[model samples]
Target: MKFTTYLRQGAPRLAVVDGGDLIDLNDADAQVPADMRAALRAGADLQAAGRRAIQAGKRQALDGTKLAPLVPEPGKIICLGLNYYDHAKEGGREKPDYPWFFFRAASSLVAHGEAGWLPRVSSRFDYEAELAVVIGTAVPRHTTQADALGHVFGYACFNDMSVRDYQKRTPQWTIGKNFDRTGGFGPVLVTADELAPGATGLRIQSRLNGQVMQDANTDDMIFSVAETIALLAEVLTLEPGDVIVMGTPAGVGQARTPPVWMKAGDTIEIDIERVGLLSNPIANEAA
Candidate 1:
């Protein structure tokens, strides 16, 4: 089942998307937990109960509600970089010996359709269209590839918007990637049972305005989702609701003939086949 968080009277609440409308999970008798983070912490029993209510059609869809980040405020937001051969090559680097990872603070996350602000600190803001895995279980060190996927809850489209200038300032990428409101994710979270975690062959593309900017397939990932998960699990514990942003394919603005950075009024549409489209507009942070 697809899940979403939306705004109602300036408050954020969880809901399940049913067909064209959204069923308010907050209205279910089970007392919709505080948020997705809380729901995940409640464990399988709570999630199962919520799913049953959604399937029973006991919820109501609100009118004129706004979409919030699918899993707003995750416990951790880990990201993979240079995991796409073409992206690595575009950055003038060789194939990585292992998955190169980084972290994005949960505060950086913005909802789909919300304005993604380009910070004035760096003028080289760029876009990265990626597939993000949402963890559903705690994975400890030394997990196998086969067991890696069992920890995933589902997938969603993520835009790892970057400030190339700031990113290259140091060997670490967190500085450039952690800018507030730069990590725009989710129109909805497609559950694992529906899409099968770690399954490749899905197409991912990004558009600036009406023109395609980035286009590729998950099959092109140098380190597949399962591999990345298995590798990360060896070091840190992967808990439910922790997010992993599998790096983007080639075709980013930074690699263009004369690097094309995003500006105010620009609209970025990240579409991942089977998952969904996540679109946001560009705006200056100072504005």
Candidate 2:
């Protein structure tokens, strides 16, 4: 089952997409009617109930309405860096022996179809199209690959936009990655059962202002989704509502000859096979 969060009158609510229209789960108390976050915290029971309710609902077609991030406000946003060999080589860095990780504050998340703000904080804004994993259960240190997947709730599309100038200057990538309204995530949360952890043949791509920037398949990932979960579980406790953004592929703006940074009015679209396209307009940050 696919789940989504959408804005209705400036408030975020959990919803399920049938064909086109979104089914307001909050309105129908037939199942676990809590919000997406709350339901995630409640674990499997609520997820099952929500799925059942969504399947039973009368399909409503949404005609080009805005979609909020699948997991709008996760407790944690763990991101992997240079997990792709091509991306690592492009950055003039050797492939890491282990998964290099960083964190993006929950405040940076922007929903699908929402406008992405180009902050005055930096001028080298860039885009990264990635596949993100959403955690479903609490997992402490030293978990096996099998144990790792047992903690996953679902998967979603993640666009980890960056500011190249700020990122390269500092050893830590948080500043460039955690800029407000830059991380685009959404379309919907596809349940773990709906997708095989590493077997899904998903193709991820990004287009900036009608020009294709990045194109790659999940199979090319240096670290598979299951491996990432297992590796992270060895150090940090993975909890429900925590999201992991697997690193992106090559063809980013910073890597281009004449760095094609985003400008106000530019449109960025990321498409992941199986997971629908997430498109957002670029706008100047508010004064």
Candidate 3:
């Protein structure tokens, strides 16, 4: 089932998407929490409740509501860099034997249709389309790849917008990746059961304004979700609501002949097959 979070009465609320309508899970069943992260922590029982809620016929049209990040305050937002072979090659690097991981602060997140601010300090902002994995169950350290997939709840489209200059300031990418309101995180989260295991072989693409920029298949990733999770779990525990943003593909702006950057009034979109499309508009920081 597809799930999303949206603003209702000025607070974030979880809903189950049914076609173009949204069924407020909390309203339908008081047992279900209003927050997507909390509902996810409740485990599969909440999904069963959500299914019942959808059957109760208490949905509202989705268009009028303001969407929120799928998990508004994910405990951890782990991202992989150079995980795609083609992307590595484009960056003038060889395929990596291990996934390069980084963290994105919660404050950096923005939901679909929201404005992704182009910082006044820099105009070299670029987009990286990625697949975001939302953790469901707590995974213990040393878990095997075979068991890692079970801990995933869902997947969503992610646009890992970067400020290229800040990214190169230091070897670590934290500063460049964590600019406020740069992470495009939602539209909808498709439960793992709804797609192929590990979400492999899906078409992922990025479009700036109306033109396609990055285009590739999830299968091209050198580190699969299960493998990345297992490797990460070996060092740290994976908790529910933690998100893993699998890396982008070959066509990033920095590698282009004439680097393409996102500027005010532009719209950036990341569309992942079977997951959903996440779109954001660009605006000056003051706007």
TM of each candidate vs. truth? 0.94, 0.93, 0.98
Model 1: residue 144 alpha-carbon error in angstroms = 1.3
Which digits, one per residue and each the tens of the lDDT, describe model 1 over residues 1-287? 77778877767777777766776665764565747767776664435655665677554553345777777888899999998888899889999998888999987888898999989777799999999888877888889899888888888999999988889899999999989989989988888878745848899999999789888889889998888988887888888788999999889999999988999899999999999999999999954
- CA lDDT of 74 in candidate 2? 86
Q: Residues 214-263, candidate 3: write the lDDT tens digits.
A: 89999998999999999998899998899999999988888998888889
The reply for model 1, stretches above 4 Å from the true place, is 45-47, 55-64
Model 1: lDDT of residue 250:
89
User: Number of clashes in model 1?
Assistant: 0
Alpha-carbon lDDT, every model: 0.83, 0.81, 0.91
- Model 2, range 89-108, lDDT digits (tens) per residue? 89898888897899998788
Ranking of all candidate structures by their lDDT, best first: 3, 1, 2
Highest lDDT model number: 3
TM-score of 1: 0.94
TM-score computed on alpha carbons, candidate 2: 0.93
